[model samples]
Target chain A: MGNSVSEVQTADDVLLELRNLRTWYPTGGGVLGGGREWVKAVDDVSFTIKRGETLGLVGESGCGKTTLGRSILRLEQPQSGQVIFEGEDVLKMPAGRLKQVRRNMQAIFQDPHGSLDPRMKVRDLIAEGLVVQGEMRRDERDARVAELIDVVGLRREHLDRYSHEFSGGQRQRIGIARALALRPKFVLADEPVSALDLSVQSQVLNLLKDLQSEFGLTYLFIAHDLSVVEYISDRVGVMYLGRIVELASAEALYDDPRMPYTQALLSAIPGNERASGRARIILQGDVPSPINPPSGCPFRTRCWLAQDVCSELVPPLREVKPDHFAACHFADAI
Target chain B: MADGGATGGAMLLEVQDLHTHFHTRAGVVKAVDGISFDVPAGGSLGIVGESGSGKTVTSLSIMRLIEPPGFVASGRILFRGRDMVGLSEREIRGIRGNQICLVFQDPMTALNPVYTVGTQVAEALLAHQDLDRKAVRERVVELFRLVGIPAPERRFDEYPHKLSGGMRQRVTIAMALANEPQLLILDEPTTALDVTIQAQILDLVRELRHRVNTAVLLITHDIGVVTELCEQVVVMYGGRIMERGSVAQVTADPKHPYTQGLLASMPTRAVRGQRLAAIGGAVPNPLRMPAGCPFRPRCGQAMNVCVTDPGLRNPGDGRSVACWLY
Candidate 1:
């Protein structure tokens, strides 16, 4: 967690910091009503992932979890805000310097099938990252590839195999191996296990956890599945319509959710343990369109406890309890 | 036709010792290997499994939808005392979408891009029933309304591509329920949809179940979806039923290691900062399935007994398990 740059002073403490992050896609075209209409994919979101800790980003699909992950890695440029990595603003860094920064910050995608190039062998795919960075010699790169292959529980023989030859779980392992090739300090695992089987998902998840401990890695684990997020995350952030509604320790968010949206999301999870005597707070409608999102509280349209005031004014995320920040007008009441 | 006449309390659809295999260039891949289960009248049975687990193949085999290179090799599918195996294509078609309807995953593919949602649903209704054009149109609007599609009349004119993912799925469900079929087969109907849309569709299914008393053979990988809708649960792996019982019995007191592992691996109801308990190894290649229990290679509690093929056997309390451990 040592700071590589002076600008990133709190080097040993925080691995990544996002301030007022906003990612917008332009919509509409030409003529009389021609104006740059933004989709507001990730709107005014802020969070910090500390060194060696996994920050779980939980939200429904299209709520900007993927967009946020990509933005943090600078895979997609943000319209505004700063992505401070190791105290250095990644958004402000030049291309050559950004390329250097990427060696320390890597990403694992949702679909293993789509992420990996089918034509490349597993060994070549893993070595691509190391080769691009030009950090190690060819022989060293090959050794690093083999070591990563073993670390992610893939056989040495699998190096010659293509992505199609392996199963979903095996392919995901290859993806992880490629990500860890450079020995990154921070990784953005975006729905890494979502496409995998329930039984196989656990294996990949456990593997990630073990690897994190071994390498002293920090993660911004983004996923829609709350249970998986809860299991892997030290701190949890619940997002809705491109804004974080609640941010707290995993236990606190699950045990005592202050936001109605958080409570509803938790209640939606089935099974006897959670379902027993717990009156599910079924939200009324679908998430509001990001194109023309709600004025104040984004979740007001679906929030059960939403009132006139909730619609009238947006609630600021304030720390109501120790390490628990909630964005709700009636956070205290909840 | 072993059982010529239907008994009063006979199961609505009884699939016994079913085997579906695909003849690939390499070899014959056993997709559904001697799997057996029953869906009672108006009861909901969930077939839970991951990809290549044979859950989808089981439902397709029942519907006689096996494509070229894939065929039902062995076993009987008794539907209302009739042996569906070796039935003529015409005879099967008479029963298909009439007595039993199938709502497949990806509504976009299941529906016709050329025609309106109403026309497709009307075709399903007209296929079995003797109805005039006006009567069919009336029924189409009614079906759309029943499935909770807003503004039925306006939506009926719109093509499949024009409708949203949720609306297109609603049209599929509407088509499935057009004839008020006794049995409905839904193969991961909501898997492609978002979570919020999934919740809506599940609610719609529950409502329809009560309204039509239609027995459902739901095939899905989501345990959460099964828990929310099903009464009986069948856990599948390597084209076989690893475990089957009442949802409460199977989920709460799982016996088979595969079933136990699946339950443990689910991310739902997990504490923060805990590592998910994942089952080791990948799903065995179907072309090269192990000689003994197909799950043995990945089974966390694999024993010497697992070397021998473990047939699905009754494990008391009306539960069935295909593991030597039980």
Candidate 2:
């Protein structure tokens, strides 16, 4: 796995490919219906996920990582660019074809309490997708739901209970089972374990890892916690204000971060054994508003190594080393 | 100051066998059951637990903020040779926000939405001290500066909606520090902010310790936060203190099985691509706690002796554990 970075993966190995995708929302038009200002939630982001691999997306709040995930799923319509899934462009597909294509892709949300319905029983919640697809019969759906619950470490007796009856960890398990009810090949998990307890978080993470292997799943795992991202991700991408600032193998990114933003983020994580002996790089100020980002680099205002060029010109995500990309003007120098 | 047990320094706040319970329709909820610890003068102590582990309730018990249906059943909360278990409402009010201040987790809810940030902080000062209007404004600005809010003069007039999350948290901290309380209680202060913002807040706390001689009682679920800011720690489970020791001793070599499980389950401590040593079961329900040891239901090292409560036993090295294995 360490040497696979340099090897050219075959075209068929690519499960999902995002190309210059942009998702923006109009801001402050005030009922006139013509707003010049736009909140650039996801701006010209491009990435690819290989088959049976996990790609982690990490950023602070309002960095557009969640928007990027929603855009790929077409839950939020993108203004431009492509989301190629299984050699087909998802953005250009017709509604009928897109509906058919979506059966292979699914999502797991962050909040267990908010994501699951209070009125619905565990059985109905897990079988909601199967019922909507209208292909599987009642008995078959029941069998599939039972199997999924067992796979996710739940008992059959739990089917009659409502979501409120279950604990947070158990509710999250039900959420995972529902996501896997259709047996998706690609899953996008957005902060799945952030709301869970420390012990239960590990349980859910281990469950996700086991399920990924048991069913050859490719995942685009998005989270704000850097340690959790580093633990579960094969490759990692760091986002700052709707742009990918750094992308590399998880090991390489943690070991040798070229971008100052990534360096500060890694150092910001407390109780990191590797960082305990070194001086922490504490970035100043809060994240800038996404509605009107800084002119050149989004992170230049808070960057310790920012120079005149950093504020004068936009930096592109370029290869800093073999298979390591960073969007900093001084990436090579770093 | 007792001058006994783990805390040897000049004691600031010492909690002895605290039992805070809530009377519900179904049954009594033991939110904090028999927990004990101390905070030294100018020292920091972190109380860590999951959602139902009673960490928040303990802080509320200390502040005497437990409302109806919830009450501090039995405990000796000693603050500087004064027992605070049965104080009158008016008497406790004097000490609540004046001598000991609290910083909540969500800054948005902590600050009033209608009031300007400056007015809200000024209200905190006006409630306790008898300062003049201009003097109150000056003190508010100084408090904001102390908490690291940028351009305090300009930000003073802005409402809570205008400031960012980090800045809002700074406002809450400034409000907490307005009277220069002898003891500060921070309940998950950085949990709502982003990582960079959390780092900034922790640094502010560290810097404030040097200027003001205030002891800190930090309540959080994150072990990392505890390790970074605290000298001593108390690990809670089912409202019980499972272990109590210095952060160095506990994180480096945890004594209790529950503590070991928690430390091992942390992602920062785990190696990549391997299965995490996850503690299997969920936290026990507050109302339907286990018969003997609160954690025995999920503990891997539970013995027959665990059927009876081991209570808190002192092992060597100035640490305490409540497990049969000890």
Candidate 3:
């Protein structure tokens, strides 16, 4: 579970691999409509999550980080892609097989208040997955639920209480417990600590890290907070409007970012002492609409280094440095 | 005593011994209990805290926007040497958007979606000023440009929904600056924007403050933002100020236990894989607050003397800390 970069890993080390994923939503019309625009929420995204390592995906809202996570989990059906999990294509799996595969993959949503069912008791909330899987009896489920509650730093008494009765942090703990109830190998935590208070935020982050080590689980940590992502991620990926702009080990990406978009993002962090004395790059406008994203390169509109070639041809994500991939035309030149 | 009021010459906003409370059926909740601070002319002060810290209540109290069941119980809100606590509704309305303006986090809620953003900003200007329609249009366009909205003329007639979140925030800022208010109160202004958009907005705010020379009262939970914008800061917790000092002094060398705890808990301050020194336990339940120091229950340095309130005491360096350890 140590956060070391395995330079020479066997093929067995790979747990989840996404190949050319495309999740598009038609806007303003039905399928029969003549003038329908597709919002490419996750446009041909490809990445992998190794065993027992956290892959942090950083992006602005509507930058397709959430959509990408959802698409990988098959929560949002992709238009086309291969969600290969342990040598099996989940996208091609039948409903029954998909249901079985889902037990190994779980999701923790952003809002604790909205994610947890307020009407259900904590015990049932955590046990619902186990109950659905039906691998354990009632007594076993009860014991597992009890054990999960304790593991997540919640007391046995909290099992009887409803979600509304608990604090935001506690509710998030309940959500975490629920996500971990089935002992999933890969967990997609989307902004898990975003809604929490500063003091409470650290507690949840620590819990997530501890759980990862204890259970030997891999994680796809998706969040907008750069600092939080850097703290937890072994490798980090920067996503711009529906595409992975840059991906590298956390140290490499932060120290010497290849893509202009990645550099701009790092500079945008408020009071980043680590990158002190670095010039701040405040992008002029909001992200372009995903429905009609800038052609060739999604980030070309806001990129400071944009040129004619940037708009004329798409920049393929290539290894510009050792283990560091970037999709900018000037990645090598810069 | 509100020492800050005496230090900063020509204090534009002085909140002294402010106690804003909510009189619900259960009991009274002291949302802002005896918080004192000052914002000098053209100076910026950040009120930093997490949720339930009374920072928002203090801003609302200043704006007189706290509704029924919640009222400013007692406090001297001296705005430009005028006591605003007992001002009549009609009297305060004259000063509300004219002399002081408020820009909150969500611009969508602040703006009227039915009307065009231009009309909303023009309306804000017309409410406090006597201007012709042509002049209003010109001023609105100018304000929009000043807030960094591109194609100001084209965007003038667009509805709030048409603008992006950052553009909507710029519109809100344009409205806030319509009357050239002396004091601007922003509550978590960039909390809802993307990091890059947030950077843009922060730059806009800094530039506007320099150009307009308006005193600012910024309420936010992010320490990085406060350190970047504000000269002075007041850290709040459980409806009271835990520490007050220059941003450099407080942030670099935090005095109070709560202040230290808050600064220590920030993920930005830690390296990768390093465990953060988090403050244990949740914020106190407002309905059932612990006696004396509200933070004592979770304080690592709790002492017997903490049973009694350690009111704001200056240890040294002109920084006031509300902890017995000082």
Candidate 4:
């Protein structure tokens, strides 16, 4: 089975691809003749996730990481762009076809407590996805639920318990179990471990890693914490405002960050051991409003090396090193 | 005074064997079980833990802010050599904001909605000091400037909602420091703010601690904040103190498995590619806490002796840990 999985992995690689993706919501009031203002939640994000590889999407709050993940899954329709999943453009797919696409792509939300239904028992919650897809009978669903409970390291007795009855870590496990119910080829874990405690976060992260290997799954892990991203990701994309500034292999990005924003973020994370680099690149000012982001480079407002060229021309995501892409004029200097 | 001796800098607050419990409908939740720590004059201490770790309860107990059904069941709260536990409600009120002030997590809720930010700051000052209207206004503007609030005069008339989240937090800090209290308790002050704003607030706290010579009791979950500002750190879990030591000693050489797991789980510059080493199992319910060690169920190196509830014992050093492994 493992050999077959490895063979399938090589053949059916590149599970999900997004190009020029933009998601914007119209704010209610505007000064210009009642014309609505658009909050550019996600603008021109492009990335791909290959089968069995974890692509971490990292940024601060309101940097559009969550929006990008949602748009890729079509949970929130993109304003414009291409989301090609399994060689099919998901945006162009009809509602009927989109339903089938959902079976392949699932999402685990940030708040486990809020995501799960309060009234439903743990068993029903885990099996709801299967029931919705009409893929199994009641007896089979119950058996699958029991199996999933064990898989997620939850007790079988917890099946009857409500969401509130469990702790934060347990609730997150239930969330993971539910996402895995459909045997999704790709999972969008949007800050899955952010709300859990530090100790519990590690446990959930290990579980996700194990599940990915077992299912040969691809993941788009979105989070704000750089350390977590560095730990779990095979490759990483650093987002600022509404655009990705750096994308590289996890080790490469952490070892040699090209973008100033990425450098600041990396510096912000405390070192595990006493011995580490102490020179922090403290970015000036807060992230500008995405509604009216700074012209050219989105990060130029907070960047230390902002010059006329940076404000005049937006740097493209060009490869500075082998397979490492950075969108900054001074990428070479970094 | 310069050598960090016991003279002059007396103990500002000494909490001995404190126990705070919540009488919920389900059962009596022992939120803060027999925990003891202290905040000396001009010293900053950080209490770090995940949700339901009783870190917040410990602070609330000291402030005498726990509402009905939740009360401090045991322990002595000694503030400036006075027993705070037996103080009357009015007497506690006098000491609450005048000598000891608390800054809450959510700045939006901490400040009243209807009142202007300046008015709130004025009210705090008015509670302790007797000043005329003009003098109060002058003090409020001065505080706004002191906390780095831009356009102090214009901001003085603006309501809480009018200010930005960071600015509102500054207003809260200004209010907390209005009376120049000897001790300031900040409960996750920057947890809800942005990272940049969090950095600013942390810097502000550090600066204020130096300027006022006020001891700080900072309760937060973020370990980075602890390392940045705190001199000493107390690691709590399931309503008990898991470990307590100087930040350097605790972060560098964590004695408790829980503390090590926390440090490990935190994504830092080191741990690369490997999945974060998360401690398995959830924090045990405070209502039905496991006998012996409260953290034994979720502990990575749990042994038979761990089941015999270990108390905080000095391991031949100044550091204290409540783990059998130690």
Candidate 5:
């Protein structure tokens, strides 16, 4: 009954595939006013999430990692893209059918404080999705809510209390419970543990892993912390200026990065004394504005390997290794 | 018993038996309860702890920045052997930003959005230094260049929103450096910046440490950053010092159970997929703190005698630990 989004067949094992997704927000003015500029939040980013796979999107803030996750979930409408979910086009689904699409996909926002409604009880907060979808009767929803609360490591008493009563980690558990209440096959977690303490962060991460195995869930995990992403994600994608600069297995990307940007990012992780001997390539300056990005390659401004050709040609995502892809002009050379 | 001051020379900042409390309607909350540490001159000290560990409040106490309901009840905050808690408002104001500057995490909040970056830097210099308007402009431009901000002249007039996160951080650093403070109290200075940008800022701080010879009090929640910047380390929990030692001694061989739990929680360079050893429970509520050890509920090594809280006594290798095991 929960598997309603698989409307068509692409004859592939991947659960979600996004092709050239672009989500831009217009800035400045409108019709009878000055020319408007578009902040290319998610510019032509393309990737796939296999069934039961966790694809970690890593980048600094303003790099559009969150926008990419939101766009894939259709939370933010993309200007143009192919959001093929379970062989069905998520972007092209009708309003009535779109509800079905949403039933199979869920989102866990970053801020636990702002995400949950303070007025609602934990019971209704978790059961809100099930109630909206009308997937079960009132009694069944309540029982399931109790079960979900227990599954998320919270007590039955917490169900009657408001979100403000719980701790940050407990509130995040409530958020997780709410996201998983509908039994969505895929979940988009955007910086879920960033707000948590180090000790609490590991608990949430462990719970997410346990839930993934128990429920057979696939996740599009978005986070800025490389260490946390490495701990959770099977495969990782490095995004910059609204584009995927590098994509590879977590271990491969950390151990053997090819793209200059990727290498710079990996080197920047504050490792221990053994790793301190290696020289860190601190980028010269901050990321350029996405509204009016640097010409040719968006990352060319900060790239150490930048040559004249980097300014004249856009780098395409090319497979440098067997399974690793890097969007750089000198991918083969590196 | 003889905790009157820094005692020995070469220590730049000494916080002795500090007790900061909040007289709220509910009750008195001992935010910084008898914590003591020292930062050597031209050396950096990092205070690492989770939220409400009194790390922030301890730093605030040092700055004499505590306000009405919250006050430093009793403490000796010696800056270059001068008493901070005893200083008058006007006297302390002269010390602040002139000999002791603060660098915070969120740069956007530090820099006034209404004014240009140039104006902010110029204002700090105008307050502290004896520079004329023309000299202040030249010095602001110089400070920006010193902070490695690209095209200092062009970026001088840019508002906080106009610059990216990293550039905004650099501008705040420029303002902090305008007065050449002997000790820089950086409260999670790079926590809000991107990791790459954080690397840049740390490298900049390392270089400036030699150039300006300024001692740094780097307070953060991240151990990796503590290892990267500070030589001395203090671990705080429930507004008390759990462990204090050289970073090499404490981080490499953490003595306190809480310190051990905190270190084990972090995902290291180990291969992916390994489960992290998470601490069992959350930090206890300050209002309803457990009778003995603040971390007893969450501690894996809790014993029967843990009900009696222990004092921070030195174990070997110039390190102090507050645990029964030690």
Candidate 6:
């Protein structure tokens, strides 16, 4: 299990590989149609998720974490990038092939109440994907839906219930069952437990973990909660205003964070036992608008050890330690 | 204030048998049903619970702000030994901002958009105090500074839309502190802010509370926040107090089953990659809560006696629990 976080077998075994991914939303501040500025939501982001591993993505609001998840699934079109899955560049896939790609890659959204359709029954909701993508008979589809409900810790009788009739935790389970209906090799769960209550959050989280192991799934788990991310993730990548600032194993990121942004984020989590004794590195001001980020390092404006050079040059994500990478010019010196 | 419980201190606010109900068309939703607790002077009391747990309603009832479908049906809200349950609207107006202040969740909705942040804070002072316009302006700047808002002079003129989420919350706090109230009620104030911003706001609140010696009534669903900002805590579930004790005792050794579940469910506290011990079942429907214990459906340690409501009883070590086990 420890080896899973530090190293995967090989690049050939990589389930998903993103290369120089750039997803930007054009703002209409300048010209009506032409000279639009980019929000730079996911600016030059890249990462890899191997089979049977969860890579946690974390950042503050508007840091482009959610945008990156949406971009990977192609829910939001990227201006340029390569999302290579199973040796296939999904971004370059034609419409016919892209539809096929969708079957292998699925998403579990944040909102349980809003994500599940109210008009649809629980059975239809779970079997919707299979009905469209599979050649299975009606009874086979029904059997699969029942199997999914049982796998997600719900009873078979629950298939007849409406989504609104279920609790938050149950609704989330239904969402998960729906995502797994197509038997995706990779699952992108975007804040799956954020909207749930504290106790219910743990239930959904545990269910997701159980299903991940049962199905041999790969996940790009995205959230703002550092603690939950650390708990569920093998490796983590910290985002800041549309760029990955730190990438490392969960242990390394928590035990020793090199980037100032990562340090601030770790220190910010309340009730970490060490929180009372430690001095928190509070970042001043709010996250800057993505339309026009700072001159150089996005975090330089809030970095405690920010030097003049920090604002002059963008720091690249470089390996500073064994199996740990941080995007800071002075990462080693720190 | 009944000084019978743990960590003996001057009693600042005491809520006794408070039942705040909502007379909706569906039925009488007992949002807060016969709940009681005590807050020490200059100390913080945390009302920890999930949604529909009556935590928010408790605070609103204290502020005499429950409107329309919701009303405080019966309760004794003793603030400095004064019964505020039946206070007239005119009387509450004088005491609302002057004696006790409230800063609820969603700073955007709390603050007026058209008006500048300065005007909103000044309005609090103008309503309760007899300070002139110039003094009000000076104090507004000071209040902003007290809440750690940068460049108070410049921020004073800025509209609520211009300031960020954390900044708007600071302004909201400044307004709440306009008259230096004896008791400050915060209802999930930091839930909407980012985690870093949340830490900053909580720090500012702790520092301000100590400086002004204002007792705090903090309401939140996150046990982490409660542990950070509170001394005493009351765990609520389905409009009832499931457990009440000092934060130290409860977090260190939670007696109630519900409290134990909440503590174990915290992702930070739980071990990495391990399944959290989540409490099963949702809160009972507010309109049609169970005739028995409200938490029985979700309680892992439910005994046969849970079929009936358990009264609050002392289980030793200066803690009170409402359960059959106690």
Best prediction by DockQ = 2
DockQ of each: 0.58, 0.78, 0.74, 0.55, 0.70, 0.72
lDDT digits (tens) for residues B1-326 of candidate 4? 12132346688899999999999999999999999988888888999999999999899889898897999999999999898989999999999998999998899878999999989999999999999999999999999888888789999999998777888899999999999998899999987776666766776777777677878888999877887777889999989999999988998889988899888877654666566777766777677899998888877689999879789878877999998776
* Candidate rank order under TM-score: 3, 2, 5, 6, 1, 4
**Which one wins by lDDT: 3 or 5?**
3
Stretches of candidate 3 off by over 4 Å are A1-10, A273-275, B1-8
| Candidate 2 lDDT by residue in tens digits, A1-334 | 1232212233788999888999999888767777568999998898889999999999999999999999999999999988988877788777877777788899999998998999999999999999988899899999999999999999999999999999889999999999999999999999999999999999999999999999999999999999999999999999999999999999899889999999888888877633456468788898888999998989999998889998899899999899899999999998
Off by over 4 Å in 2: A1-10, A30-35, A273-276, B1-8
Report, for all candidates in order, the number of backbone clashes: 4, 0, 0, 3, 0, 0
lDDT tens digits, residues B203-301, model 1? Answer: 889888877788888999987788888888899999888999988888888999988888887765443356666787778888999988999998878
Model 4, A134-206: lDDT tens digits are: 9788899888899999999999999999999887888999999999998899999999988877777888888
Q: After superposition, how far is residue A204 of candidate 3 from its true place, in Å?
A: 0.2
What is candidate 4's fraction of native contacts? 0.59
- Residues B1-326 of candidate 2 have per-residue lDDT tens digits of 11122245678899999999999999999898888898877778899998889999999999998998999999899988688987888988889888899999999878889999999999999999999999999999989889988899888899999999899999998998888888899999999989988988988887787678678899999989987788889999999999999988999999999999998998853478899999989888777898889989898888888889899888888999998776
Candidate 3 collision pairs? none
- lDDT value, residue B285 of candidate 5: 77
| DockQ comparison, 4 vs 6, better candidate | 6
Clashing pairs in 6: none
TM-score of 2: 0.96
Measured with DockQ on alpha carbons, how good is candidate 5?
0.70
Q: How accurate is candidate 5 locally (lDDT)?
A: 0.88
In candidate 1 the C-alpha lDDT for residue A319 amounts to 97
